[model samples]
Target: MMNSKQVIEKIKEENISFVDFWFVDIFGELHCMGMPSYSLSEDDFNDGLEKLDASSILGFKSVNKSDMILKPDPSTFRILPPDYDPSRKNARIFCDLYEGNRAEETRFNRDSRGITAKAKGKLKEFGLTHSMWGPEIEFFVFDAINIYPSPYGATHSYGGSGYSIESKESPWAKGNASTAIDLKEGYYPSQPKDTLGGLRKDICDDLYRYFGIQVEAEHHEVATSGQSEINFKYGEMTEIADAVVTIKNVVKVKAKKRNKVATFMSKPIFGDNASAMHTHQSIWNNDTNRMYDPNDSVAQLSQEGRYYIGGLLDHASALCAITNPTTNSYKRLVPNFEAPVNVCWGLGNRSAAIRVPMYLKNREKSKRIEYRVPDPTANIYLLEAALLLAGLDGIKNKKDPGDHVEENVYKLSAEKKRELNIGSLPTSLKGALDAFQSDMKFLEDVFTKDFLDAYTELKYKEYHAFAQTPTAWEVSMYTDA
Candidate 1:
């Protein structure tokens, strides 16, 4: 809660020798650079900590063409963990990128953080105060993940026997080696069966003690080998996004120290449960919870809350381009496997894309709607901002999300589903992108046309690159013919 001047004075008082300016690209890749704490005077902090050339950081230019600026957000200041360097402890702040003139006419097209800030301002303009977000980030820890690519061949190994509780070779392996569960079936097992139990605990401890992230819980997800999920307490939209990047970094660093690899690649292993960062969100009006109503309401969700879900469901297809933004993300959206493919909300139903969790009963503050489309690979800032915008649009327009289908939607006949007005999410990245292109008015407040155009160009290039690659399956099926 300290101002920029107070933060600067505190840094000097704490004898912090250096300050690391941190930021992320549109793809959620973290970037950092350091400056001497002596250079971080009170005036400098108030004026903003500025740096040169963030073009590379924004994926806008190659090394040769890079030229941009970074200005630290004073509120994002924090002391670096002791373990990163025991001596000469460093302070850090997340930064905003800008281009061109600093005063009156700075062209800041490439700043993802700037876009998010603008989005927040727009939300305020629309009379929405605070947007709360809880991200259930899921990932897989592997004993070894080897990727090799050559002109003649390519191979990757996702270690598993399709059915196994304990790996004979895993150091964490213990009892019940003979009674292993099948692939994508490792949800909430005990010690020996859950190889990553100790690791998850260690990761959670580090997040709390080091980064100060309040982890709600950590547990095994529905994937046999090394799949896990860690739930953090709900936070302000931007704070949650920042926490996500920090959490991922901490997990990977800690895993590497223990000779393991962690991945958020949505669908790292074929025929297994894919990772998803299912987001739960709610709106608040000062001290009151706008999304909660204990009186005559379906599933205890307020009328405004239902409208928010309606907005999300209405724009769900376009939302996926930002939320489930990867080619691998599509692999997990298929029917079954507890993945929510249908665009509907229901209480205690896993088949619905939006589920009002029954676990938080009697806790008014905990009431929220979960959007299950997002994966960990998304830029959390953009995803959260877009969802907020869409939901606000729905509320503003009084859009109704309609009846909740408690029954399994997959089992319903096509005609029956049509009668019920159930719609499935986009099955491919291209489809998602196409949907975004047409139905992304809500995003315009945050994502400018230039940002969207550049992002589309970059993603399409990646898609084409993947398309040009000859997979082993293709060779096996058609090389002889």
Candidate 2:
């Protein structure tokens, strides 16, 4: 970890002209406020930036109580690559928000970063020091993207909302009838068929070179039309969340430089597989992996591991409200799309919500659970914190995760699923919010009541907006009826 003195000296050595303080809204959209490098001192690094009105930020505060401080975390300090900011010598540092002018002890209740910090502290109560996470970040890159909604202040516009995306790898693109990628057979294709290979390489390089994120693998994903996945090395929960936010920003900026657009929306296309951020996680003490067991021959998952999975299944529906926060997230969770809908655990079963990967030979060091339900739209801090709380609750209550299914869960009959006491995830954002309202006791230790209330209120507004909007599909089907 970099201390204030080291950070200040590094800034002087690097001659960084400006420093950008970064923080996240409830939805994980990054917000930045930059200051000239000369304006900062050792004291500023030790204390924080001046208090600002946080009312403008979503899910933060009302106009009446808007004061908050941005306390920089020097450990997250990094120099932005030239490609990301060619106009100037720029650096960025993530921040923790605190109540107005108070000591750092008085953290803002609604600050997602503060919530993550509290979640980490809770691990110590369970005799664990770290919760490691690795996410398979997937997305799609397109040559052009068009949304047919009227711009703000427009006097005239179309009657219905619509969108169109174009990609050279797509079958429908001009002159791609012969060269287009096959529908669901786009996985692991080489040079000619995978037109986005160079783009993915550029993204991976930037992630490692500028952001210090180590790339494990990069390749074309299952879906066609420029879909890609980049695997990054796992780390502690908060640090990994920081990497996730950085990865998304780097992908978008790099794609734009190539005259392309990238999207992390769960289901951007119909009739094909959608993007997902399947997360792999495990718990650890100082030097021992708490989730692994050598004596268990079948799966080698320890009792603690079983309890964690139990917690995830117990709170699966409520977790959807945070992990898959958007209305369109449900559209991707349906059956037959490789996305998980059933709430169950299994060994190496992709159809199950939590799949225990068996490929790793080093079970003691590498054993972990891959939660397949989450998509890329989630706020990283909230998602990790909520998941940890739910798991810890299971550990506290000694919740039992039922038998691990060996068969494909999606193919199981409804009667069979019922016989096994299996349940399905919430089918929509409203369903998830409803579940969250009743099942939030697990999160009480880390997430403040006020924070959750504001989150639910903000998400309900999102659901209503999407619910009330008239889509082109609706107009087309009902126009002549």
Candidate 3:
């Protein structure tokens, strides 16, 4: 880890032309504002901060309370890859947003990054030193996209965003297509069938070389077009949130250089797999793994681990508002495509919301639960905070997650599912909002009430906007009648 002085020295030695101070909006979108190397100041970099008008950003401020400060964290410093911008040397550092102008400043309540930091600090009460998350964010790299939806009038051209795969990258191109990986069967085939193999590899290699995120694996995910994943080793909550933003940026930047568009929007394509951010969560103190148990013969999860799952299941409905926080997010959560509709935990069950991955022998350190409902569109900072808080509630209350659903819930009969008392997640943004409004204790503990209100207000506006819009599908079905 570098101090402010060390970071400044590196920038000078590296001949950096520009340094972008990075922060996140409430929606988890990365925002960068910068200055030239001549403007570098150690006092502001380390002890003090740079100022900005937070009122202009979404979910942050009113006109009267517009002021905010950004304090760059030296540890998150990284130089952009040459391919990213060969014209000028560029580097980035993540920052936290604060509201007050005084010496003792308070973090901006709506800043997602700040809320995550507070959530991590809150873990101190449990004697847990850290919580780590690994999100398997799957996305598609398309050759081009066109999104144009009309909303105000019935006669207007309606909703439909066209996504097409480039002929060279697509498996379905020739006059007589060369066995096009058949829709949902694009998992793990190398080269010929897996067209984006080389691209994903480049992304992984660059992520490690630039940002110090070691790639665990990269592979062709289950989709025909260009769906893929570049997995990385998990780290602490705040650290991983920072990495998530960097990873998405690198993928998009690198893809654009090759004349491709990388998208993380869930359910971009119809009748095929949707991109999911299935987050794996684990807790530890120092170097000891807190989820494993040597004495327990049943599933090998500690009492604390089971309770954590319990808390997650108990609050799964409300958690959706944070984790799957988009109108498109619910479109991907439907049954039959392995996108988790049932709110139950299971061992190796693809249909269950929570899955305890059966790790290899002697790999107890890797034992953790994966929450599968979230999509890449979520704000990682707020998503992690929700998961950590929900898990902590489970640990404190000793909530027991009863009877794992080992069988495929989709295959189970309605009578059997009813017997098991299994529940389904919120079906849409409206359903999720209802759940969120009903439960505020866990969410409010991290997000200030004002922030929560603003967030929901914005989300409701989004939902209503979409809800009132006319779709091409509706026109196609009813126009003839």
Candidate 4:
């Protein structure tokens, strides 16, 4: 990790023209302010910009109490690749939010990065030194997209009211569509069928060269319309969160450069596989993996691991508000698309919410649980914090996850599900928000009451707006009636 001095020196040595100070809001959207490198000082890197207005940022603060600071975290300093901006040299550093000025800064409760730090600190209280996370971030690339408005009484209408997307990867593309990928058959197609392979490689290259992210693998995913997945090596939760933000930016910018549009929406398409950010996680104590146990004849999960899973399962519905945080996310959580709809844990069962990967069984270090319900739309910092807290609660209470279901969960009858005590995840964003209302005590250690209230209020606004809107489906179904 570089210190403030080192970062300043490197900026000069590398001749970076612009340096962006970056941070995420409570809703997980990235916000940035750029400064000319010549104007940046060591104090800017150490103490941060002291007068950022928080009222303009969602879930931050009211106008009366909007004063906030953006303290740059020097370790996150990275040079942008030429692909990101060919016109000029650019770099970025992630920042932590603070309420006070440079004289005496205090952590802002609604700050995404600060919240993550608090969550990581909680691990120390449990005798765990670190928690690692690996996210299988999935997305889609399209040739073009059009977003238009539904006419309102043949008069004025709000813009961006409806949307459509196009891709050469889809069978519906206009002429020369012979190379289009068949429905749900885009997995691992070669050059002829996989038009986005070069784009993925370029994205991976930018991630490594500019951001220092170690991408493990990249390929087409299970959707025919340019759905893709890029697996990155796991790291501490906060570091991984930073990488996630970087990955999304790199993907979007690089795709745009290639005359394509990339999106991380949970369900951007219909009747096809939707994107998910299946997260693999594990706790560590010193050099040992706390999630593994060689003597366990069953799934080889340690007691701690079982309890963690128990916590996750018990609070799965509530966690959805943050992990799957979009109205469209529910559309992807449905069955038959490799998405986990049931709140259960199992060994190698993809349909279950949590799966214990057995690919490297005896390798203790590789043992981890993969949570399949989360999508890329989530704010990485908030998502990881809530997940860790839930797991920690389970560990403290010694929660039991019960027997693992090895069979296909989708095939299980209602009676069988009831017999196994398996439960269903919330079917909509509203349902998930309701669950969060009852189960939010688990997050009290890290999240403030005011922050929770603001978050829910914003989400409710979104839910209500979506519920009240008229869609093309409604127009098609009930317009004549």
Candidate 5:
């Protein structure tokens, strides 16, 4: 990796006409400011970028008096592909924010990227070399989405002919062999059944060419109407987070080109499977796999692997705030829907929160545990980092998450589940927030107190906003009265 000065000199030598400084706000929205290439002198680059009123980025600013500085992380610098803007040659770099004159003393508490970097550092301090992550991000493509708000009524309607699976009014549904598929049952169906197969291919191709992300595969998800998933090869924690954001952006742009709108909302349609970002993770030592064991007694997972699961289950509630943070997130967590609501792990089981994948047949290097709670709407940086910290904590304590539950947790009797010590996740966003508040230590390890407080405040505001809005259900129930 080049130093700041060297990075700047190289950019100039390469004739890059624009520099894009990238950073994330408290809500994990990616923000950027661009500077002409001529303005970025070697001296200016060495001094680093500066912004006086960075409190605005905190998403909880009232006074707006805080001073903040942005220093670019040279390792994250990459040239923008020609496809995005052909005429203006561009390079992008992720920035680290500092609050004080002494760069080492001041840290941006709300900086998601910084928190992730700190988490990775902590992992190394505990003798771990690398943390791998594979996030299966699911999303919905709608032809059109309309939102209406008023004191008397509120409703949202989504319609589109491009990706609609089936409807009496849809011409494509009536014997249109090339695009027709059974509504709500299009999982892994190739060609004709996969209506958006071409769209998925285009999205993946653009992501790989522009961002250099290695896309493993993509397919139509179980949800029949426009639900899809793209799987990227596992990368380091931070890199994977960056890739997540990039992939989302690329997919949305592709959808827009085809007159469609893409959404990562956990649950967009009633009675349809919600979009989720099921994360698969593994810990690795220096060039060695730490989670794999050929001699394991159960599911071929080593002692370390079991301990990692123990940590995740123990801290699952607290982790929910970062993993499944939105109000709609709970709608997907309900039972009998393939979503894992029970705190347990099992081999080849989709009902368990932590699933030991059976797909890694004959591939020891690919062995890892799948954490099923997260959604694509989450801040990928914070989510992956928090999981790494929790797993490390587990290893330090040598925690053992006992025997696997082979039977479906939803099918188990209440008394039987109680005997087995199986616990359910929070039923609502409010419950998740409460859980996060009670378990502050885990979050504190990676985030400053101010950042956590600000984040909680923002989320509370969102919750209340949703609460104040009248839903269509309310009108149906009250109109008769």
Candidate 6:
């Protein structure tokens, strides 16, 4: 809640020696440039500018056009948590990417955070005062990882087996020869069975104390070998995206400091379950939550709420290119993992892509919808902005999302789904890309044509790269046959 002047005064009074000006490449990879706090002048605070080589970043610039500036947002400054290094007096500020050195510089078209800002402004302009997001980013922690040059080189050990590991802190560990948590059975056990509880609590505490992230709940996830999920209070689109990046960074650092490996890969194992980002969102205007109504036809979800869900479902396939951006993302979206595969809205139904939470308990302010098709690997800023835009379009068109399912959609027969006229989500990254190509109008205003073209090219290249690679299964099936 501190302004730039207040932040500067605090740094001086607190004697914070180090400051890391941070930003992300187009691929959502965190990049940091450091400087002594004393070296930063008031102009740095006013202009929000720093120079960098954009060519070094993916999806940014060619080698021939590498010059760029980073404009740090003053509101994003946070003192780095002292959990890992108690003696360090470090702070971090998130930056926006731009082309020129002046205060009125043009933002690089692919600046992910800049896109979020524009999207936030668009929401207000479109009659949605503010869009809020709450996401549970699931991840796994491993004792040790090793790999070689076969397939999955350098990180293959992380895939398939041995994930239900017994680490030093896990009560099940007896010098690495003890039993591990059984697959698909690691949800909320006490001390011994759930070894990740302490780590989750530590992360929650540190995130709140240092970064002011509002941590609400923390617990173990469905996967046995240290899969975890932490819930936090919702905020505006940009801040929530910022918190997502901070969450990933803080968790990775905290794990490393404890000799553990924390990974957010969607499908680390084949059978059990995979990590997902179930994002909850609501649109508000003039201090009123428009998504809910006390005297609605059903569940108090206003017509606007259903229309928004309709818009999301209408563009669900296209949105996947941003929400579930990676190839591994489809592996998590498949059937039987509690991840949604149907492009349908349901009241409290997990199998449906959009779930109208019944826990609102008639609290109009507590109303929102949860979209479960996303994963942690996504660029959060883009994903949040795209979702808001989709919902806005839905409002404009008054798209009608049929009444909620209220049942497990997976349990329904294919014929039954046909009877209800429900559609299914795309099955692969390629399919999602095609959908995005076809329905790009929803994103045109938010993600410019240039940005979309570049993003599509990069993603298609990634898909083809993965597609052409022969998998171990193929070799095992055909080498001797």
lDDT of model number 1: 0.79
- Model 2 C-alpha lDDT versus the unseen true structure: 0.89
Candidate 4 matches the true fold with a TM-score of 0.97
Task: Give Cα-based local distance difference scores for all models.
Answer: 0.79, 0.89, 0.85, 0.90, 0.78, 0.84
In candidate 5, which residue ranges exceed 4 Å CA deviation?
A: 1-15, 58-62, 81-83, 100-105, 149-183, 360-362
TM-score of 6: 0.93
Model 6 Cα displacement at 139 (Å)? Answer: 0.7
Worst 10 residues of 6 by lDDT: 160-169
Q: Which of the two, 1 or 6, has more TM-score?
A: 6
Model 1 per-residue lDDT tens digits across residues 257-298: 778888888987667788999899988877667888888356
Span of 10 residues, lowest total lDDT, candidate 5:
160-169
Q: What is the C-alpha RMSD of each candidate to the true structure, in Å?
A: 4.0, 1.9, 2.1, 1.6, 3.9, 3.2
lDDT per residue as tens, model 2, 44-151 = 766777756899998888899888878899999999978767888889999998888555458888888888889999998899989999989999998988987752
Candidate 4 — which pairs collide? none
Candidate 4 lDDT (Cα, 0 to 1): 0.90
Per-residue lDDT tens digits of candidate 4, residues 87-176? 999999999888864456588989988899999999988899999999999999998888775534224455325678898878888763
RMSD of 2: 1.9
Ranking by lDDT: 4, 2, 3, 6, 1, 5
lDDT of model number 3: 0.85
- By TM-score, the candidates rank as 4, 2, 3, 6, 1, 5
Q: What is the lDDT of residue 68 in candidate 1?
A: 60
